[model samples]
Target: MDLFEKAAILQYRHRRIGDPGRCVGWCSTDSQRLRFDVLCRVGDTSDSQTLATSVSTMCPSSSTKRAGAMVIFHAPDLCRPACCTPFFQMDYVLASGVLSYRCRNALYPYKAIRQMWEAATRGPGFNLLAANVFEASHVLCGQNQHAILAFSRTLDPAAELVTGSVTDDFTLLMRRRAA
Candidate 1:
């Protein structure tokens, strides 16, 4: 990120909510709702299952399940899984900016996050992988869609955009390739 963006983020983090001129990050309630709506639309919430990493917005118990589609989340610090399992052999995975982006105090390289998600998609019985990544690094570095293509693991072009825009942080809906 550039000096201005860094400063803006710092200012926003330090100030209280509703403070003037401060922008909300990916974890904000409104932002979460926006991303969740996209997921619901694209994932065919009527019958498909979902597994998320975070606890607040996407957790199974906290959020309503649509049409009996099982929704499960695991976060050690905040909420425990309904089945008391850390990771499920689920078919669908939904990760927000937190999983792939350098948010809060956790930082990860673009390639690392990309590889991780790709591996998860390749897991047995996995079907859909949906996520939105922080786009500042990709945009600021002038890499165009190269970073996004890499993030989606486009080695064989399996992932596609289901919603949102690529100019900023956007969502991607990917399907696992049949083995």
Candidate 2:
């Protein structure tokens, strides 16, 4: 099938699942909250200057913005350029970077990976947290499969995977390296 056909089928499947197009990879609201808590803790936003990538619903940009924090709030369907574009207009002096989730790439493919590299400086790295279930247990599972493959194809080419850990969720702290 072509891209449009694939998109239509995916939309149909989302409608049948009774989910908004943005709700990809999450099984429930509770699980989503749990993941958010983990991400916030891991990313460590105590310093007001810290920059982060967070789920728009889970982490309101307003709260961060109020505190003079720069956060890239990601929704799979909306804000595609913020999530996918390889460059930001300003020079972001990178600190040891924050964590990111790959579920956001379900629709945009590996653009997130490329964007992260472009956003960070040379030494300090960023974390990539992703989990993919291969079988299509439901419509969202197919999106997960797409995410898994996108990571496989794009991650190694973009950054050096410095350290990794896997449980129910997998996290990889990747450093910016010469391409």
Candidate 3:
């Protein structure tokens, strides 16, 4: 698949929710509701641990889930350095009401990250900047989850806007069709 297509699939699989046999729970937003299930295998245990650690360091301990599977909701904001610059922000009503966000850390390529963020806030949902550092990151992460949501654009222009949940794996990109 092309890079954009691959990115979108990766975002969807990573942010997927509902009962996937391994994880199940309830999550809600002001106007929407979701159920999430995380599917993984024995070999993925270490990757799960790393995700837990990264989440813990960035968010409160209670916000982090360490088990092989669990559920949660996440809201996110995509902020730019200047006020006049367009920004992207949205909320992800996961199957579980777990508030999570991700910031566009310096680690990602600037152009790709900006495009991903634009694909989010420009879609449906409320536009609100998060309050705290953790909250901002949570929103940013939610935007990241939209990588798949953005890919859906390739299939149907009228499809509902997409959003994603945070995940540790990048291999999900291998499953998408090239443009």
In model 2, which runs have C-alpha deviations exceeding 4 angstroms? 9-22, 47-72, 76-81, 89-111, 121-134, 137-169, 175-179
Who wins the lDDT comparison? 1
> Which one wins on TM-score?
1
Candidate 2 whole-model C-alpha lDDT, 0 to 1: 0.37
Is candidate 1 or 2 superior in lDDT? Answer: 1
Q: On residues 3-74, what C-alpha lDDT tens digit does candidate 1 reach at each position? A: 554555445444534542332333455555665555544344445556564423442322345467666555
Error of 2 at 128 (Å): 8.9
Worst-scoring 10-residue span by lDDT in model 2: 90-99
**Model 1, which residues run further than 4 Å from truth?**
1-30, 41-49, 59-64, 76-88, 100-145, 162-168
Angstrom error at residue 87, model 3: 36
| Cα misplacement distance, residue 96 of candidate 1 (Å) | 1.1
Ranking by lDDT: 1, 2, 3
The TM-score that candidate 1 achieves is: 0.49
User: Across residues 88-121, which tens digit of lDDT does each residue of candidate 3 receive?
Assistant: 2321111111122232343332333334324332
User: How many steric clashes between backbone atoms does each model show?
Assistant: 0, 0, 30
